[model samples]
Target: MKLSYMASLAALFIALPAAAQPSTRPMGPGPMPVFADFDGNGDGRITEQEFIDARSKRIAERASEGRAMRGLSQALDFKEIDTHGDGGLSREEFDANQMRHFQNRPMPPAR
Candidate 1:
């Protein structure tokens, strides 16, 4: 019984290192930023200025991490996403725009 318990513990220890290691495989394109990401002031709306600032911040973060910022280089601006022409974006408009843009992009084949 002592030998069996020791073997079990040894197996667990061996497996732990592997389990703790993060996956090296690419996680594919990152999630599209939503209105919340652009709503820097948490005001539940994204003005054009807020959109540009937030996008720049996001780009800087991804660049610093050496991450490929795919699907983010869309030609979209705040006016494009502000479907209602209200001069600001609502969550619904943002989500709809994401669906139209991000969801339609063809993913690259897995290596």
Candidate 2:
């Protein structure tokens, strides 16, 4: 009886972790994946090299799709958004620039 009880407890411990594991699936199509992909070093911050590489990859993808690749033109202007001139952007700085860009963009006509 004691052996059976020990086995059941062991099984419960193993199953709990498997059940608690976070889903590998994305919650939805979103920019979080883009940010994570660009963070090549797993350092939670993007260096200029990582940024450029990611941009190049994205441009290629867009070209393959026969899209105009309009966004790439401004994405590499790192100096403008670097703010502190540090030559690298933390996630905060990157997101700040995105917010600024979104805020300044002209609204489309109310259709």
The best candidate in terms of TM-score? 1
State model 1's lDDT.
0.81
Query: Using lDDT as the measure, which candidate wins?
Result: 1
lDDT by residue (tens digit), candidate 1, 1-111: 999999999999999999999765545666677777889899999888998898899788877666666666665788888889999888898888878887677685578
Could you tell me the C-alpha RMSD of candidate 2 in Å?
11.4
The Cα local distance difference test for each model comes to 0.81, 0.66
TM-score of each model, paired residue for residue: 0.67, 0.54
Worst lDDT 10-window in candidate 1: 23-32
Model 1 steric clash pairs: none
What residue runs in model 2 are displaced by over 4 Å at the alpha carbon?
1-34, 103-111
Which whole-number lDDT from 0 to 100 does residue 77 have in model 2? 71
Native-referenced Cα lDDT, model 2: 0.66
Against the true structure, candidate 1 reaches a TM-score of 0.67
